[model samples]
Target: MNIDSIKNYPTGSSVKHKRKITNALEYRQESAELCDKKSVNRGYSGSFTGIGINRAAANDFKNLGNTFTDKIFRSKKFQNIVEIFENKTVVASTLVALIVAGVARPLTNIAMAGDKDKEDSMYAAAHAISSAVIGFVISSIVMAPFDKAFRKIKDDPKKYLQGLEELLDVKEIGKRKLEKSKPYKKISKVAQMIPDTLVLGVPKAMLTIALIPPILKYVFHLEKGKKKGAAPQAAQSQNLDVNNNAVKNNPAFSMIKGGVK
Candidate 1:
């Protein structure tokens, strides 16, 4: 703190607070020094520690690993082994494995947080590897049957599309049966629509609008047929005159009040 700020404080309280701050600063410095000493002496065979076997073993193991890795990578047998995992199925499985490993982090955050007291380095590493293996196995199992079909579809898309049309229950559009022996009669709205919408991705608004015309035509034609059949019968039921005479010459009508007056 600035001298002026310290001077602003009451003399007694300021000296007390100043001593407390000084002690805190000294404590922090001592802690930092201890940490530095430990880190610096970590690799050293200091008076308090014992043998240097671990350091020598680590160096030798590193050199041996490097030698083997270089040899394996350069060998033709290794290249062939690498090529074995280069196929579509294994590549797809590898991709799945990587994705599953990445997803495992957030997924384990809650569950592992409660179960384990603290993280262990080796356990974390093994869990990541296991996650990838689990994903690879699952993806392989799921993609097995589809692999040959996928290859076939990729080879000949037209055949695959024909098969898809059959699966989706689509029929050839506008192929009218001109030579049909029987007359054509309209079918229900559901039967009329299924083929068209099966191709159109099932848009409800468009399907409803498309159905209006066929339904309207059917209704109008049905009403016209009923009218045509009823017209002659209606005419035949009209009242008939018993005698060929005018209204004034009819005897029953002349007997009434204003019929013949």
Candidate 2:
């Protein structure tokens, strides 16, 4: 009989109703299993998964940053500055790469060369190598103060801000609870971008600039990858495989491990 006809007997005695109940039970079990998976907690109020402040977002920021640097380097006014960086950071291996790939790569091949050949492995290899040098040079020169500033903030953001306050002729740090001021917000974003500029921005930009044929190589190419600055650090669980195995194998380990911690 249909479920509608089951009113003649108690609900559990109805086969259709029992089947529906079994389905619900299975659905609930599946939902419970999903809850056991990882979810990023949303700032104490809620939680979400695979949404907002993710890796792709950070990579976008870095790529944008590298594009900016590319413009700066390509500017006619910045030739001297770029040269300074090229001179300062280019070590022996980089010097060789710069000379060989930058100079020889262009003059050696005519018919063999052309950026339209996207599948050419030799071109990509030469580009990645040569671009790495220029990338290191530009990032190193420009990011010196940036590196120091980020390091200062990373170690102690409060102290760094307080130092700025003292320099600005505000009351000493301990005299009052130092707070964010208008100028702080203005400088915060540019200041925070330094790390990503070094790590993701430079490397991606290197691959970018390197890929161009000898003429426009310095003016183009940027593939920004990450922004460590904006991204909050994720707490990592330590791998203790031996300890886990011991606890599983010996129930007595539960007491010993628990008590020690």
Candidate 3:
């Protein structure tokens, strides 16, 4: 008989069907046995594996949450402005030096030395050393107020972050009720800028008045210039453009333009 005719035969009388069923049953039993052996070797049952994974993940999450809440949010309050300023200044200074040195490297390669081999090498070495010293000094001066500002923010993370959030109009903190609280109320605009004023003024006035030839020339490379004010001109030009556009689009600018002219 053909394969199709064999399928039409009754199962109880069919030897081929009986043999296939027996082989399928044996394969299923072998698969189950192998699975059990592998599970035992790995020391895992389905129930225990899931529970162990969930418990470990939960513990790790808990530790991370606790560290953020305890160490960052609550423990450090803004108290010592001077200490905060100094520490921040040091970090800022270090960062400034690193940035300046990176920028000065290419400049050194170009402008550092003459092409006579030995003389060029000596000049290059001297230039690098001098550049390093300049970088450190510039960094120290630049970082003072920056560090103070950092400390101010670090000391009161929420308040500082809130103010920035407000200034930027960030949506996450925009509607938070905590922004109207006592800590946020205590800081003023003038107080916020105090560190900057002091940092700049003290060094500047000292450099301008105390030094004979002006240390600012060599140290910071100070420049002098005056910018002409342009507020009125900018406002008038913007108004004129708006008027012209409104006349072009809405037919209302004609009357307004005529009156203004």
Candidate 4:
């Protein structure tokens, strides 16, 4: 019974009943605490298990990345490409220029399309072609002498690199030895590129710009009979139309126009 029922019983019986009730409550509290401890232990175990699983997955991914990288490094085709780029520096540089000017620049211009003053895609193509041609021609001509000189040095490092043997810390440097030296190879590549980078770059760009108009006229037949004065007025009128349309469609302009009305 409850505490109220114990009050109607004898004093000694009531005290005994109260003791029994207290013992039951203490046992239930202890059982609840034990259950809580068991749940906490289970939570810790599950957390550790989750951590172990994540660590295993991470390790698997790491091993897979390493394996893929190792395969690429060991591949014969990859090695051959690397060897070609290292040995055929002129070819490498020319290919880079072609990609930048002919491929990348033209693609960028086409993607940008009508964002600029020159709306004609053919003009962009012509410019890209001119740039690529000028870069290839000028680089080949200018780097040829430097390449020949470096080749001579590579052929006989003993004669050319005589005084710098001690600085390089190698005795009797051979062609193979010099080729294998990373620092020397880097220096040789940079030295070969110097004339093209410093001397020919700006002059070649200027020459390309000077040649683009004639190329567009003769080769592409664009703007064939247009007068210079008319062309400027037409271009300016087109730009004004574009700007007016942009303003008319703008959200802020719409808000201002609505407010004014």
* The candidate that achieves the highest lDDT relative to the unseen native structure: 4
The CA lDDT at 85 in model 1 is 46
Candidate 4, residues 1-261: lDDT per residue as tens digits? 364464334445656544534455654564455445755434332233222344455465565536878789878988986875665565567667677756776676567666443444445455556556656676677666777787788778888887675666556587766755777767777876667667765676567656656766777665524522112111111113235335543666765543321
Q: Model 4 has how many clashing residue pairs?
A: 0
lDDT of 1 at 116: 35
lDDT of 2: 0.43
| Model 4, global lDDT | 0.57
The order by descending lDDT is 4, 2, 3, 1
lDDT of 1 by residue, 9-40 (tens): 44466666555344555545644554457565
Flag regions of model 3 displaced more than 4 Å. Answer: 1-116, 157-261
Of candidate 2, the 10-residue stretch with the lowest lDDT total is 230-239
Error of 3 at 133 (Å): 1.7
* All-Cα superposition RMSD per candidate: 37.2, 29.9, 23.8, 25.6
Better of 1 and 4 by lDDT: 4
In model 1, the worst 10-residue window by lDDT is 233-242
lDDT of each: 0.39, 0.43, 0.41, 0.57
Q: Assess every candidate by TM-score.
A: 0.23, 0.23, 0.27, 0.49
Deviation from truth (RMSD, Å), model 2: 29.9
